[model samples]
Target: MDERKYNMAEEVKVFSTWSSPFALRVIWALKLKGVEFDTIHEDLSSKSPLLLQYNPIHKMVPVLVHNGKVICESLVILEYIDETWKQSPLLPEDPHQKANARFWAKFGDDKVSSIWSDVLMKEGKEQEEGVSASMENLKYLEEEIRGKKFFGGETIGLADIALGWLAYHLVIFEETLGLKLIDQEKFPSLAAWEQEFANAPIIRENWPDRDKLANLFGVLREANLGKGTPK
Candidate 1:
């Protein structure tokens, strides 16, 4: 908390939604930095005026407002938070290591968006193919883990926070879609990482109500499959 940047009069706020992995990333980063902020939950069905004003182009949840300046995009916000608050640094001090962390962070996000999202909406042969590809994508992360406590070496950092969605979304996908996203028997390290990351105190405390989120995903799954209501 740099005194110049941490003004007592300034207010920090995040335009968020209940089930947004992106929004939650911003929240987790803030908590990690020990920054006090308020979350204004948004109904995506009806986009709020402020949210639109803050993020005119994307009009998405996770529009972070600090003082009067607005920040959009989760990954960008994570970098911003890291720069603003120096304590418990998110990226490494070594330039080469920091660059590597950024690379993997983007890789994880790309895989999650491309592989997992496609698999979520697929079924039958297509779904099988998607799941197989997803597994292959995760193997890169498995190799990256390489017996380390986290991607950040010791504690959670940029790559860990960026990929934290797997800790929850994979679980949700497995439960709702009945697809095997992570197999502990094969990818022991990734499985262990997910369990530890999901249950970590800060992450766990901010988790959305699973019952509600699971029901939501179940409904989405049914819709994607062109089926009747979920059981």
Candidate 2:
């Protein structure tokens, strides 16, 4: 009759790298769910055997091993967690709402990385296009979250977790690139939502150190600039 005994049967292992936005996606989901997990930090420079074994395709970190079964791809892993544990609901019960949330999540996932390219590597037309795309994506998000506290509507859900990568990781790009994509006056809704997200204890406590993340961005930017990979 003890719930604690039942909880012990469900355990998870997360393999992640420190500087990966994709890895942070899984971390935020786990933290939001209040799920106790064993975290193994992987050195991306030298791939771990365990990581390679779990994710033979991409072999990337942010691999969630639940009850000995491995789930890769941060978004997919999040869906798996939500389906497995219903304690802290990450997705909506309504099918329509869930679909809408997934749309925004996909938008952010696909377009947000381009902002990094804009900030770090490309110049001239390529950089301009990246900036334009980033702005358009933010505009869509602002419209979507106009009256809602979170992307999933009212409560922090999977979409919020997916887009939360921007909350911390973007500051560095903003600084390094000298771009201010989110203007409070221009996008008041998003600005307010960002504050709400940061104030949330789960998110606040889990964010990467700003200075450190910024330094990493600087290094990556320099490398990408040299290689001309921004486009």
Candidate 3:
């Protein structure tokens, strides 16, 4: 544990949006590490000046400010948190396993956004294509966690935190869109893992408001696709 690197007295702030999965990733990581930090929720419609200043390039939430230095991007922040606070290890101790965890975390990051936009946001033919692609991507993940309780084995880890959206928010997406993307029959392991992940103590405690998220997604889907709310 390198406590010197992360000054306990200095400010540790997380600029994030409540509905953002990326932001939730940081929140989970911080909670898992038992790091005390202040959360500043940003209104994505009109981002805050602090968010812009901290993450000039992305201009997005989940910007972690430690002391005075800023770390943007959820995965990067997770890594920074893990490195800075080594109490509850987020990554595997073995180098090979750690690399594998990073790989899947990156995979989840790369694929989840597209899945949300294409599958959840779009409709008709586009959404059908997105569903197929998402299933394929999820199949790969399913195999990765085929027998484990979580992507990080018995306990949650970096990859599990990275893909936490799948456990919590994806249900809201399904309800809002009235689509079943992660069926228990189709992706049994992944589906089972979802329940286990969401039921975890820290995750359950910090879970987002389901109805609020569903309503938000409903509005976003309508605005993005120019279609009335799904039945």
TM-score of each: 0.93, 0.92, 0.93
Which ten contiguous residues of candidate 1 have the minimum total lDDT? Answer: 1-10
Q: Candidates' lDDT values, in order?
A: 0.85, 0.81, 0.88
lDDT of 3 by residue, 1-231 (tens): 455455467689999888889999999998888888899989988898888999999999889999899999999999999998888899989999999999999999788657888887778898899988998898899899998998999889999999988987988788777778788998899999999999989898888788888888888788777666543
Pairwise TM-score winner, candidates 2 and 3: 3
RMSD of each: 2.4, 2.6, 2.9
- Model 2 lDDT tens row, 1-231: 454466567778889887787888788787777677878999888899999999999988889998889999988998998998777898998999889888877888787667776645777788888778788888988898899898877778988888886776775678777878887987889888888887789888877788888877777776766853421
Error of 1 at 50 (Å): 0.7
Model 2, C-alpha of 55: deviation from truth (Å): 0.5
Task: Specify the highest-lDDT model's number.
Answer: 3
For 7-85, candidate 1 gives per-residue lDDT tens digits of: 4556889999999998999999989877888889999988988998999999998988988899999999999989987
How well does candidate 1 score on lDDT at residue 146?
Answer: 70
